[model samples]
Target: MSEPMLDDDALLRYSRQILLKQIDIEGQLRLSRSRVLIVGLGGLGSPVALYLAAAGVGELHLADFDTVDLSNLQRQVMHDSASIGVSKVDSAITRLAALNPQVQLVAHHQALDSDSLAAAVAAVDLVLDCSDNFSTREAVNAACVAARKPLVSGAAIRLEGQLSVFDPRNPDSPCYHCLYGHGSEAELTCSEAGVVGPLVGLVGSLQALEALKLLAGFGEPLVGRLLLIDALGSRFRELRVKRDPACGVCGHAQ
Candidate 1:
């Protein structure tokens, strides 16, 4: 098939991204035609949203129910002090739109539940889970598994961060549940545990990069592996992840 024609503005805007041999004009076209759903507008969600929008993803669906607070300014780069009290989704979309008007923005001004979650996951080619809470992470993972959409998941707290891709498209790959074991009932949140600011930026940017690679059909993703970052010591580690045979989610299929 002939590649979609890029307008002059698109060429100039995405010149750097397009220059990579892995993401040439053809790959840029794929990016321009793709859609991704991001859950959350907090720490991790902030960088994921910004980089993805700047990379020229065709459409981005931003989901978050919380309103911006003064405390959020530390890491939620998508919002400013003036945005306090405004819906996070609105704040994020406004910032992202300002970054790149070439992409379409879908703002979901509501929290994600099973029903809404499935619908949102189903609508996008890929999903990025940047929410800090484990319950929401599990719900997003389940929805992605049910929809068979690829997911780039990231988390950060107290200078620790991890990122991985759960692609049902890869039969042998594990879903988030297989690696994390459905999360404990005693899951922790950044609000309670206290997270470092840049930790979210580091992990979330990687999530955005993985999503773009997945959508553009280029680069080796973090599929079947979890990357751990300990910024306090400036260390990095990776663990190979595989589907659990007797486990739920992708296990049976694998």
Candidate 2:
């Protein structure tokens, strides 16, 4: 596909980013034509959506089955007090539209099952697993693996957060299942564990950064590495993650 031409207004709007040596006109144009699917419109999803839209991602598929609650305002910056009780995707669309009218926003109000999830993943250039649970994470991973798309995953609980990128097209990348097996461990929710507002922002911002790097083909993305952030301590750590050959999700046997 021929690259889309950026007009004067676009160049000015993205001037700061375009000025970067790593992302000149070519990279900015790539970002302007990329499509991304972000599942879940909660805390992490909020910032991911905002940044991607602000950065001029051509299209965004926003999926969220839940409605906004008053409590969500604490961290889900995409919605406000007036948006309480409204579907999150709708609320997010309002904010994202206002943020960048040039970007197309597609809302998926219903939760995605296996078949639907795979279809969604197949239709997008990349997938963002911003959902809150292990089941959703596993399902998103499986769909991305099947479709061979890059997946940017983020999570935040209490004062800690984690981020990782898994690209099925890369044999060395470790998928969500490879790291956290299909064991039925208890899942933790922000409501239950009590998460700090900025913690989610920290992780979600990184998720957006990594996604942009992957799409723009600039800088080293966190494909085989896991980033852990201790917000309370204000420290960050990176751990190398290896693909599990015997894993059920993305293994050759499977």
Candidate 3:
């Protein structure tokens, strides 16, 4: 089928990106036709949602069961003082609509059960795992694997951050579980470990970039590569991530 056509206003709004060699008019149109699901609305999700909306991703499904807390204002740029005490999805909608009304925003404020999560992953072209906990990340990974969708995952804690892309579409691309392996609940959360606000912001911004690359069909997504950021020391490093043939979550060849 032909892609959705861009109107005059859309052409003007995305003129800068359309001028790029990598993301010419074609790429911008692909972005305008893409659909994505983000699994969090906290520090990591804030930038991911903001940039993707501004860049003109066709539709975004935001899933966050938690309400906005005052503490989230420090990093969750999508939510402001007025948003405090409201659902995070509601807050993001108010903010994103103002940024780009043309972009569709779907809310999933309820905590997703196994069935709901699977359905959510199945509906999207790609999934971003911005959730803070291990269990949610694991569930998202499993859902993506089962549906054969690409998963962009990011994590930040204290002064450290990590990012990677695991595409079930690419047989060589490792799933999230392949790298971390049965993570223990002993993982320290940002609240408990005390995360620096900007660390997550930086990671989330990169995650947004990766998503844009995949959606707009420009540049290389971080497939099978792990990025490590040491914020305190200001260092960036990339490590190759190999798929584990014995991985429990995604063990079979497509």
Candidate 4:
């Protein structure tokens, strides 16, 4: 498919990005031609959907089987009190549409089984695993590896957060399972362990930035590194990750 031409309003709306040589008209056009899939529509997906929609991504595929709850309003900034009972994808659609009417929004408001998840990953240029569970992250990672697509995965719990990018296209990059095998004993959700709202916001915002860098074909992605956040001390740390040749999920992949 041909890349869509940027209209006059689009040029003006994204003028600041176009002003930067790293993401000039060509990069903006690439973003406009890209399609992305976000696995969850909670805290991480909230910022991801907002920024990508505002930045004029041509298509966004939002998938979530949950609905907004009153408790989610604290960090799920994309949804409001009025949308407490609405489907997260539907609520996000309303917010994203208002943010950027130019970007097309596709909703998958159902629990995606193995076959559906594989199909979803194969249909997108990239995948963002914003789901707040270990099983979902592992599932998303496996799908991305099978499809040879990039996956930006993030997690936040208590006062800490984690972010990483796993791209099967890069042999040096580690898949999610390579770094976190089977699952960690430390996998805790916000509901069980508790979390500060802003910590999630910060992590989600970074996830959005990483997606933009990947889509625009500029800046180095965190493909072989893990970013750890300590919100209690406001400290950030990076850990180098190597691909595991013996990885069961991605060893035979790519």
Per-model TM-score, in order, reads: 0.97, 0.97, 0.98, 0.98
- Overall local distance difference test of candidate 2: 0.92
Residue 189 lDDT in model 1? Answer: 82
Local accuracy of candidate 2 as per-residue lDDT tens digits, 1-254: 86579999999989999999999999998988899999998999999999999998999999999999998999999999999999999999999999899999887899999988988898899999898898899999988888899999999999999999999888888899999996735878888989999899889999999999999999899989999999989999999999999988899722
Q: Tell how far residue 91 is off in model 2, in angstroms.
A: 0.3
Error of 1 at 168 (Å): 0.4
lDDT of each: 0.89, 0.92, 0.92, 0.92
> Cα deviation of 105 in candidate 1 (Å)?
0.7
Query: Could you list the CA RMSD of all candidates, in the order they appear?
Result: 1.3, 1.3, 1.1, 1.2
Number of clashing pairs per prediction, in order: 0, 0, 0, 0
Name the runs in model 2 displaced over 4 angstroms.
none
| lDDT digits (tens) for residues 1-254 of candidate 1 | 97678999999989998899999999999989999999998998999999999999999999999999998899888899989999999888789888998989998888877898899999999999998787888899888888899999999988899999999878888899998885565878888888888889899899998998899988899999999999999999999988887767666663
Candidate 4: worst 10 consecutive residues by lDDT? 181-190
Candidate 2 clashing pairs? none
Which residue window of length 10 is worst by lDDT in model 1? 245-254
Clashes of 4: 0
lDDT of 4 by residue, 1-254 (tens): 86568899999999999999999999999999899999999988999899999998889999999999999999999999999999999999999999999999999999889999999999899999899988888889998999999999999999999999999999788899999997675677889999888988889889989999999999999999999999999999999999999999998776
